[model samples]
Target: MTETTPYDADRARFTRQALARLVLCDHAVDVADGAAGLVATENDPDSGPGGRVSQAFQLIELAERALASAVIYEREQGSSWAEIAQYLGIGPAQAEERFAANLEGWNTAFDVPYRLDETGRKRIPQLPTAAYDPAWACEKLDRWAYVQRIGIDAVSSGLVMAVPEEELPSVTP
Candidate 1:
């Protein structure tokens, strides 16, 4: 007879919770990015006033949760000012000024964990640099560029759910 480990149930539950958390976080980011784009198009000098304004308002309503989520995730991820600025495509000072208050409050609310090294510097997990698939990478690059042109808020928000599950392109033999 094989013995079943009781620890397995706890592990499975933890995994599920973790996956759910990640999914929610990602969803938030995506919404925020979408909202930022709508705002930009509405603000565009060349865009006609009527349709663009309505679209922007609609996007804002749709993206509030996403923007909140991105702020929370970035704070938890311990993103540096420079990194955040780069993500926003703005000067570091501007990024900090724009996001610092919101980011701080969001981080505190989420109780996101942080690590401190021997040097007492806080550390964040590095995002994977390699794409799971070349095609997915190309698509992501294009999407990122487009979002980036609108604002960093869009980029940050987009990043929340930007990881595609199909990137690995499962193979069956």
Candidate 2:
């Protein structure tokens, strides 16, 4: 017999990706802090003084990549402009503009041989379903609607769900 839970599959995938990102972040920290085998220390007579500075630069570059990757992931997961803006602590218009600019810069700098289709347009993959259960997907739809209804920027990091205050059951205790 097999057991299933509403959050199992999605949570597992999210947990794996989240752990990978954390590992990258931790490595960045280790490099920047001169821990681990990131670079030779000054105690080593042959080591150069530029080691720490270069490692710090690498940390910044890795952090930038992590942030960009997160934004792209959120977008592909059906996050709205407002949700992204809220996460970034910016306005929706600014978020959209900045993301577009960043996407262009990323493509220009990182895309090797230019990944385009036969029509000369960039190829975009079809998005997968957000959740396994259609009923659970309804909650996500409601959350999106709630975000739109109030016209307030709501922070969403793809892990937490924000239930409306009214919908929450009152506790007598």
Candidate 3:
């Protein structure tokens, strides 16, 4: 994306927006990598028909999906249409019109988490893949975070749960 994507604060670490941002970044890297490969093969006549251009083209669609996810996340986080519109450079009504269906679908997904696949045996998640499988997203984003800033220890993401006092072992020395 040409514009900066929003991510949640540490207190809301690994929120949908954060995961969507991670996906957006991943798409960007993919685009860069495909471009590099295209460059590398430019002079080589023997390296023919690798479909690198196709791969990069596909990234645009993925980036759009990622952007929609970001919008949905922003709405979910209680950002008003005007606030989201400012960054998008459109009027609030326009912004809301563009993203309202996405927001609706996002909300509906939670109400109906999954649907039956064509086979009727397999289940297909209604939620976006990253948000649907949050543990995987956390692991991936955590590593990305660690590489970007050492010692953050994003591996320990999410609020810590307290153990029951009665379950504690005896502390006699």
The best candidate by TM-score is 3
Instruction: Give me candidate 3's TM-score against the actual structure.
Output: 0.58
TM-score against native, each model: 0.34, 0.37, 0.58
By lDDT, the best candidate is: 3
Better of 2 and 3 by TM-score: 3
Candidate 2 versus truth, CA RMSD in Å, comes to 19.9
lDDT of each: 0.48, 0.50, 0.62
Candidate 1 per-residue C-alpha lDDT over 13-127 given as tens digits, one digit per residue, 9 for 90 to 100: 4332242334344554456556655544223555565765676676776565455445445555666768767877888798778767655654442243233467865443221
The reply for model 1, stretches above 4 Å from the true place, is 1-55, 110-173
Window of ten residues with lowest summed lDDT in model 2: 125-134
lDDT of 2: 0.50
Location of the lowest summed lDDT over 10 successive residues in candidate 1: 125-134
- Give the range where candidate 3 is weakest over 10 consecutive residues by summed lDDT: 1-10
Which residue runs of candidate 2 sit more than 4 Å off their true CA positions?
A: 1-46, 102-173
Give candidate 1's error at residue 43 in angstroms.
Answer: 26
Write the residue-wise lDDT of candidate 3 on 21-120 in tens digits: 5545554444544554444433444435756556667767666766776677677667899999999999999999998898888778656667778987
- Sort order, TM-score high to low: 3, 2, 1
Residues 1-173, model 2: lDDT tens digits: 12444544543555323423333343344343443334333334343788656766777776665566566556655678899899889998998887786556433422231234677655431112232233444465556546545532222222233786678989996
Model 3, residue 78: displacement in angstroms? 1.6
Residue 158 in model 2: lDDT:
23
Give Cα distance to truth, residue 120, candidate 3, Å: 2.2
